[model samples]
Target: MINVLKQASEGLLYMSESEYPFEVFLWDDSKQKDITPECVLQKVGLPVDTLVEVVELDSFFEVAIAEQDWHNSEEKITVKKYQHLVQVLKKYLFDLQVMRFGKINIDVYIVGKTSDEYLAGLSTKVVET
Candidate 1:
């Protein structure tokens, strides 16, 4: 778990799928390999007993991935879908900070590139609602 957080702290994104407008990806370096929100909370230093598990978020994500036509696509995110995900994360995991868009490395993967290169990029994307 520390390795995951260590990699994430360096600004390496965890990409579940690599297209563009990456869906099912976590830029915060807070996610474990399993990509469970519960694991995210755990990584952010939240105690296990206090976790308010939202199983629905996982289910929603699975549905979203299945519904999307991912064939040869570059632009992958819909504003509505992105916003909904942010809202859900905010609601369930308020303590964790959202990843800034400028911090995203375009070359995303499940384990990330293991570099903090994107941290030096522009902070054009607002993380707040």
Candidate 2:
């Protein structure tokens, strides 16, 4: 609750809702692709229900975002849909951050169910631009 860093680490972010003591690491393209849609699901530990987007970064890897296509599509999609929202789709190169390998926030856009939820268990207000 304090407006201070509750925890800090080298390239790792602290999250509250984590069931396991998890550390978040950015996808190192030097060792991997910008974002493999398949690997991202494995990293998130969720199954595919709906695909929200597929972003192609300028220098890094391409990202195919499959919305958490769970059985309970209604509830889950409500929460996951906003993550892959395209402010300008099909005509632009965008920057994306690996938000826990599951969730992601595109800049200049407030996505997800709500700001509090999207920014929840996150370090910065918005991903580093």
Candidate 3:
């Protein structure tokens, strides 16, 4: 599963209004019953008191894959890359989620349950005003 994620995310950057690379991570103890904002924070070693916001997967992708200028080849490529990554994540994972921790500078986790019941996916940082 990790290998699949690596291949899907290779050379693709999450456009948080800023470009950032995605890093794959797996949490062996995360079960479907244990998926909560607090639980995720703890598993990822984030401060327990840190602010956490949850956004639906589709909502995250709506902004992430928004159309760019038609003339900018780079921007077009980026959109395509994100689209492809989204498809791969949806195809391989279940109970997908998007979590943002913090204010202007946010830690983003796009995680879901793998077939083996472990939580695995990608994490990245985004700076937003």
Question: Of the pair 2 and 3, which is ahead by TM-score?
Answer: 3
Best by TM-score: 3
Better of 1 and 2 by lDDT: 1
Q: Whole-model lDDT for model 2 versus the true structure? A: 0.28
Going through the candidates in the order shown, the clash numbers are 0, 2, 0
| Structure candidate 3, residue pairs in collision | none
Q: Write model 1 residue lDDT over 1-129, tens digit each, in one string.
A: 323333322332223334233333334543333434344344445445542323333342454434355534432444334444434443333233222211233221222211331111111111222
TM-score rank, highest first? 3, 2, 1
RMSD of each: 13.8, 15.3, 1.9
Per-candidate TM-score against the hidden true structure: 0.23, 0.23, 0.87
Best by lDDT: 3
* Candidate 1 clashes between residue pairs 3 or more apart in a chain or in different chains: none
Window of ten residues with lowest summed lDDT in model 3: 63-72
Error of 1 at 120 (Å): 25
Model 2 clash pairs? Answer: 34-61, 49-69
Candidate 1 CA-lDDT value: 0.32
User: Alpha-carbon error at 43 in model 3, in Å?
Assistant: 1.0
